[model samples]
Structures are given as structure tokens and as C-alpha cells.
Target: MKTELIITTYNNPKALNLVFCALQDQSRMPDRIAIADDGSGPETKAVLEKYQSYLPLRHVWHPDTGFGKNEILNKTIASSDADLLIFIDGDCLASAGFIERHIELAKPNAFSTGSVVRMNAQTSQNLTEEDITSKRVFDAQWLRQNGNIKGLSDSLKAGKASQSVSRILDRLSPVKITWSGGNASTSRSQLIAVNGFDETMRYGGEDKELGSRLLNAGVKGQFLRYSAPLLHIDHPRGYVDPEIVKTNRAKIEETRKMRRRWADHGLDRHISA
Candidate 1:
């Protein structure tokens, strides 16, 4: 299947370079690397220019335009020519066999996916070797080998639980939802039917909202449990709005409500695993 690796970026040239290096090693090289970039600094452009001469790459950029990731992503897909679309952060590095694994899972009405691990740059790990899968993640090998990566006994880690939860809000198996936006993939047709993503959303909740749409669409989602293990480089979780947390329950309820709305109107169908 013709596929495109879509990476969204904003102000992180070093991370993008690391990601490119990983892509170069993919067992199955993507036909094209479509960059969905919001307004990044000049340094990022320079880096991209250098890489463009040697790789099958495309750069999609827009004005700072304030919180326009969803919009940019939506348009990028509409303009691209790949049947399947794989989304990864520009700062992320693909496992050696990442592309091969995803292609291995391509199926109609079925979206193949993988898990992401979170890591930090301040760590003392080997950036070159460990960077094969992802730099930010520390114990990526163990997690990928075991088919799961978890953070310290804290809250969110690089494993099946959060990765699965981040993708979906309902109790759907296979299509695991996750909070981390590092590892996730779906078909281009499915995305277009839902109008891509809700552009109104700015900060967080994009992934959850998208998952809700998928569940409603009856597209069976399956976690590429053993295939694509991603490293979600850990970053400092900044202060979120008190209301976003306080009204968390209400948000879930609202999500369910919207899910019903989509289903009732013959819009999207939700499937169980």
C-alpha cells in the first residue's frame, strides 16, 4: 500500500533530525515524509532544507496562525496522495522496522497502530544507540521487546494502558487511546470522513476527540501490540487549567453525548475492538 509518514512539528530541529535518521533506517521506507508544521523558527527551515536534498520529503507550513495544528494536518492530508497516513511528532524517532510494521498491519476498515514511550533529553542515556527508536525514551528496548513500555510507578508511562486509553474514551479494545501524542495512525479515508480533526480545539484533547470520532465510525482499531513500539520522550507536564481538570468528568460526559450525536445522525459508528 502506498503510504506517507506525516510528522507534525513546531520549533524542534534537533528532534526532527533524529527522527529523519530513524526514518532512513526503516525496513520499509515511506514513499514520502509530509511535514505538517505550524510556524517554527528559521532554524527549523534551515534544517529541513538540508535534509530535503537527500530524501523523499515534503514540507507543509503555515503562519504562526495560533494553534492551527488540526487545520494544518487536515489540509496536508487532503493535498497528499497516500492511501494510508501515519502520524508521528516531528521530534520522534521511528524504530528500525517502524514503517515495515505499519505496512504489515494495513487493512480495510481496520487501522493498525503502535504504542509510544515517553523520554526526556536531560537523561544520561546513549543518544545515538537509544535514539534508534526514540531519544526521549529511556528504557525503549525493554518496552518494545516486551511489547509495552511504562513510566515510573507514577501516572502515565509508555505502555499499553495509557497508550490505549489515549486513543479511545470508550471500552473499545484494539484501538487503544493514549494521552501522549507520539504514537498513533489511521487510514486517510477514515480521517476525511470525520473532517479530519476538530479545528476549534487548541491545546489538548485533540487525540481524545479524534478517538471518539473513530469509535463512532465503526472502524475497528487494533493496537500493533508487538509491532510498532514508539518512544514518547518525557517532558515537563505544565500547569493545566483548573477547570479542565475540575470539569474532567463533565468532559467525558460531553464526549459521550457527542458520540451519540454522531451515531444517531448516521454519522460515525463506534465498534468494540
Candidate 2:
């Protein structure tokens, strides 16, 4: 299947650079990539331009609107034409087998969500493009030496599990699987069926709301926590507002209570044929 990668970003060009370096080493490269830019500046555009020659890339950007991640993502989704869609944050560095594993385990009528190995601010700051390109950033020893050892065991367990073990964990894990925009994949048809993400959503639980809708529509959520692991670079969330959080949470609750299968303020309203 033709798979397209969608990475959401704001102004963190440094982190995005590392993410691109990581993607450059994917076991299975995506057919295309679309940046879901939420009003970033010239720095991000420069980063995109730097890698444009090496990757099949498209930048879907708008004016600096305040925290319109869902809106930008919806626009990116509409712009992509690949049958399969893989989503990740621009600050998250994919492991070498990330794309390969996602494609290998992809299922119909279902979306896959994976785990992240988070880097602290110090560790994130210290990482270089060489570290990402060589995948030394995912090395347990490197992570430990860099002060990311707190969750090393869990990170290793998730990143190194065999396919059989991963499948077993997926089947038996007690944790409820949710849609994580950072490391997840689903077919374009399934997303469109549910009208993509709800544009009314702000920041918190927007991804989860879309997942809830998919679940209500009988699309299963497959947990890939032990297989498709990625490293999330630390960054500040300056846009997170308590009022917005409360509003988003209420929207999510409403979607759950109503079992909404389609979003009124989603792709249909923004996407053109």
C-alpha cells in the first residue's frame, strides 16, 4: 500500500531537523510526506526547504493562527493522496524500522498507536543529527548516559520486542489503546469515513476524540506500543490554556456520550475535490 507520512509542527525547526534525519533512515520510506504546519515562521520553512530535495514533501501551512493543530492536520490529510496515512509529531524521531513495522502491522478498519521514549530537555538539547541518523539516539547506553535512564527498561522492552511478542502484548495489555498522533497509522478511507479530526477541538484530547469516533464506527484500535517506538524530543507547550483544555475535554466527553461517528467541523467542510 502507498503510505504517506504527516508530521505536525509549529516553530521548532531544530527538533524537526532531527526528525527528518531519522526519517531519512527509515527501513521503508513513505511514498510522500506532508507537514501539517500550524502557522510557523521562516525558520520552519527553511527546514522544509533544506529537506525538500531528498524527500517527497509538501508543506500545508497557513497564517500564524493560535493553536490550530487540528485544522492544519485536517488540511494536510486532505492534501495527501496515499491510501495509508502515518502521523507523527515533528519533534519525534522515528526508529529505523518505524515505517516498516507500521506497514507490516497495518490492518483494515483499524488504526495503530505506538509508544514513545521521551527525552528530557537536556538530552534533547544534546542530540545531534549524527546521533539521529546513526540511530545512536535510540541506544540504551546513549540514552542512559544522556540522563534518560529513568524509563530505559520500558523503552527497551517496547523498542526491541519481536513481532510475536508485540502481537501478544497487543492482545493482552490492560491499557486502553488510544489514538496517538505522534506514532500512529490508518487508511485514508477510514479517516474520511469518520470525517477526519474534529476542527472544533483545540489541543487536549483532540486525537482521542477522533479515535472515539472511529471506535464508534466499528473501527478497532490496535496497540503498537511494543513495536513502533519513537523518541519524542522535549519541548515546551506554550499554547496550552486551561480554558481551552476544559473546552476540549468537554467536547471529547460529548463525542463519547453521543458515540459520534462523524465530525460536523471536520474534513468535509475544509477539503475540496
User: Which numbered prediction scores highest in TM-score against the true structure?
Assistant: 2
Can you give the TM-score per candidate against the true fold?
Answer: 0.74, 0.95
What is the TM-score (0 to 1) of candidate 1?
0.74
Clashing residue pairs found in predicted model 2: none
- Per-residue lDDT of model 1, residues 45-103, tens digit only: 88788779767899888888776777777767777788988888876667666777677
Off by over 4 Å in 2: 157-160
lDDT per residue as tens, model 2, 55-82: 8889999888687898888888887889
- Each prediction's Cα lDDT score? 0.62, 0.85
Off by over 4 Å in 1: 124-181, 236-253, 260-273
Q: Where does candidate 2 have its weakest 10-residue lDDT segment?
A: 152-161
How much RMSD separates candidate 1 from the native structure? Answer: 7.4
lDDT (Cα) of model 2: 0.85
